[model samples]
Target: MISLQSGELFDTTIKDLLIPADKVAHVQLGNNLEHALLVLTKTGYTAVPVLDPHFTLHGLISSTHILDSILGLERIEFERLETMKVEEVMNTNIPRLNLNDQVMTGLNLVIDHPFVCVENDEAVFEGIFTRRAVLKQLDRRIKNK
Candidate 1:
């Protein structure tokens, strides 16, 4: 639980709100767009992290990225999904946070992203801090006050 004071909310670290990587649904960089789409669909997430075999964070893959990559001049080219890799279309310019970062830092980043990936000093995937978790904390604090 978090302290009710507004100032205390700012003191909260992302570590407390993290959704560990093991529990998060993700796809590998080498996986084909077909596989990526399946994972995204099965998980019901718009986007998911792309990781290497070593579990290092690489980028993010989204259904929109997959769809756009397979779009042809005249119609949807579904065949490309089997040939193209997730690495080819993943969005690399992603917002990241460290476990020690404050909730306010996450609050700022999640304004644009639904979730922000968390990485260690080595850039290894640690987990994610989500907008939903931050909002829940804020809602709790407000109700307590």
Candidate 2:
């Protein structure tokens, strides 16, 4: 069994477990709200990180947020949604982690959020620490043992 008697493996660096940004489908800050809805619909992802052209993590956009905004707008015109940008409705308070932070720093975050955004030392968005991905890694270790 891949047992860490003292739970020491949680100390593993997140860099070793992260779902690299390139492997994920992210939304751009300037992307239209309609585009956000489409991505969530197509990907079936509850939320997706919003990045700038330089891949800086700005916020997270979710289907719920898009739906809420549309309902609040009370407008049926698709053009309205097209005119609004992801930055306008994306959640800016989502949790963040350093690209090299220990996995322990991400465990608590995964308990609540679907994923935690990771950034490099330059504060550039690097990837996501997804709950499923983390669990999968742990499971793989156990199985291999």
Which candidate has the top score in TM-score? 1
lDDT (Cα, tens digit) per residue for candidate 1, span 87-124: 99999999999888998899999999999999887889
State in Å the error of residue 114, model 2. Answer: 1.8
- Sliding window of 10 residues with minimal summed lDDT for model 2: 1-10
Q: For candidate 2, lDDT tens digit of each residue in 1-145?
A: 2244477568678787788888888999999998889999999898999999998889899988887777645565566687888999899998899977888889889999878999999879889898997778678777877
The per-model lDDT (C-alpha) reads 0.93, 0.84
TM-score of every candidate relative to the true structure: 0.95, 0.88
